[model samples]
Target: MIAAMLKVMVLGVCRDRGALAMAFVLPPLIFVVFAAIFSGTSGTEMRLKVAVVDEVRSDETTRLMDAIANEPSLRMHALANQSQQSLREAVAYGNADVGLIIAGALTQDGEQSPIVIVADAGRSMAGPILSGHVQRLIASQLPGVALRRLIPSVDMLSGGLTSQQRAQLISSTDEMNTADNSKSITVGESGAGLFRMEVLDGRGNVTVSYYAGAVAVMFLLFSAMQGAASLIEERSSGIMDRLAVGAAGTDVVVASKFLFLTLQGLLQVGLIFVIAWIVYDVALLPHLMPWLATTVFASAAAAGLALFMASACTSRQQANTISSFLVLVASAVGGSMVPRFMMPPWLQDIGWLTPNAWAIEAYQGALWRGENTWALLTFLWPLALVAVVSLLCAFALSRYRLRLG
Candidate 1:
């Protein structure tokens, strides 16, 4: 009996390609993606698109522009003839990462003018990136002056003039004569102050709100997969054929399964946010309506995807293997496991194809960005559409599979 069972087990393994792929192929692929996500930042280059409106038109202002242009990381976009307001708008709407305006003369009678740096709060890195360039330029020209004020979260930084604002004191010293070239760096505070959440990690900092959405979407896929696996179970137990004989037919069976999975997914996702709120202090209650709307659409999408996967596979093992592999791949590419921002431009574009990306984006908008109904719809609609399409495809595929069986 033992020898016969061993023979049967070996034969089963040989027949199931999905099991072989899951055991041997999928693990390495997942490992590769995880490795890339963790170490990829070291190889990734940080590039900032800088929008500039040079109203000063002075030699000193020209020097400042040149200094900015010389930074390897800064890509200067001179918006010649554009107004300062236009520069600010570009950054506000994300057309530009950082906005720079040089208004008035750079210096008059040894008094330096301020260079305003306009940046969006959502792009927190841009502010520091631009500021670092300015700091380097200042150090190169005005050696002894210190950064007077540094504010991280606030929208604006005032370059309030002090009696010793200029590097004139340094100019008095022959070893470091940069007093005359001292310039004040003022940040333009008019950009939209979008809500941002930061979570510290030993490895690095993460946007807590963004990851909250990502993690929710990731687990949602798993929940939907688990719920839809009932289809495979029913088929194995000869229940699917019996259900197909009912009044509403297999269509009702599929719809009921989809509905059940969707509700289950919603509950799973809700619990995720509850944990986020309790532990991470994420503000969800204030935007509960839109958050619920986003969750409904996201859950529907996951449910549809799960049904589609269930219909496409031949057996329980195959469905499990395929669904798990595809879900993990989608999560990795869709900013669930790794941020879309951290991905290469090509991969970022590819991420848009996944429902996970849209779901996460919707959650981010509703939960943290304070986007209203219409704005939330922009992301949610795509997910709803995907859910509809996937359900249709799953229905058709299930019919075909039933006929074959």
Candidate 2:
């Protein structure tokens, strides 16, 4: 009886092709997906990739920039301009996440003063956390004008000048130095250019400003590939033939697949988030609005991806082989599995063209950019464009060929 039952079980499993595939593929797939998603920066808090545009060339700004750069909480990317727009654009284009705009006037003298912080509200991996650190550094360094005035007076008096006279003399000396070499002075403040970064690791752990691109790219690409799997199934089962028999037409069939794939995309996102929440303790509730915003793009991405798979192969086996290969290759290029920073400069340049790159960047925009839902309109609309393009292509294919595969 036991041998009969075992034989029956083996036959049932072999007969159910989908179940067989799922049983063999699902576990490893889930493991690889999550492993790629959550692997790294362990015990390290996410830092902002800040672009500091030092206009003043004062020792003060340099000190601040250097300090922030060295801070474990901020992976800084120094820029060439002080305007917020350029910094914001850097973040928007997936070049960097956060930035500092140091106006020339802000560091005219060797004074520890407040500088402009240009937070990329669209895709900062840790904007708030890094911003807080910046604020704290300023607060600690600059107590009050009256108080700071007293600490430095002891040195000025040694030069045999009164308080007002000493101030004038120091200012004059700094001006003269600037007139010689623009890079001669410290970056932002009046200190002699010596600076250090002080960051707390655990504090940054809750923030994750650094991992946005990594997670976004991996998961978005995963959704795309998974959605593409439906194409393989459709080709295998001969569903394309039955769809053409009705007046409902090819558009209807394609639309149904798109909708199905979109739903599947949502489920994939949900699964990743669930794993993240259960294990990594990343915030999902407070970030619900952004999550939804990301979901909008994911749906469109699913359509484009499914279309690609549907068109790429004539047989189910070929579709599976090509789709999986393309996904893995794209993910590698897009910085889904590895840090883009670690890859060669040319690879980084090429990565921008992949949808995986865009999705990752957009996700970063939502997760760490600290903007509300309304801000996502600009970030999300391109994904919809891709979706529309995919649907149009698939519709055209169906109209011309009357069947996919």
- Candidate with top lDDT is 1
> What RMSD value applies to candidate 2?
10.6
**Predictions in order: lDDT:** 0.69, 0.56
In model 2, the runs with Cα more than 4 Å from the true position are 1-50, 55-193, 198-238, 403-405
**Alpha carbon lDDT at 175, candidate 1:** 36
Candidate 1 per-residue C-alpha lDDT over 1-405 given as tens digits, one digit per residue, 9 for 90 to 100: 999999998877777787678777889998876666555433444446788777868655576677778866666766635797778666654456677766654332222335567765545566655766665664565333222211222114444434453343334432332346554443233111111112111111125666878888888898898788887787768787887777766677789999998898888888888878777777678778888999999999999999988888778778888888888888988889775645544555678998888987787667655666677888999999989999999899888877776
Candidate 2 structure quality by residue, lDDT tens digits, 14-116: 9866557656765577566435433432223334466777667666566556657667755666555555666666655456655566664432335443455
Give per-model TM-scores: 0.70, 0.55
lDDT comparing candidate 2 with the true structure: 0.56
Clashing pairs in 1: 167-179
**What's the C-alpha lDDT at position 276 in model 2?**
63
Worst 10 residues of 1 by lDDT: 194-203
In candidate 1 the C-alpha lDDT for residue 191 amounts to: 17
* Candidate achieving the largest TM-score: 1
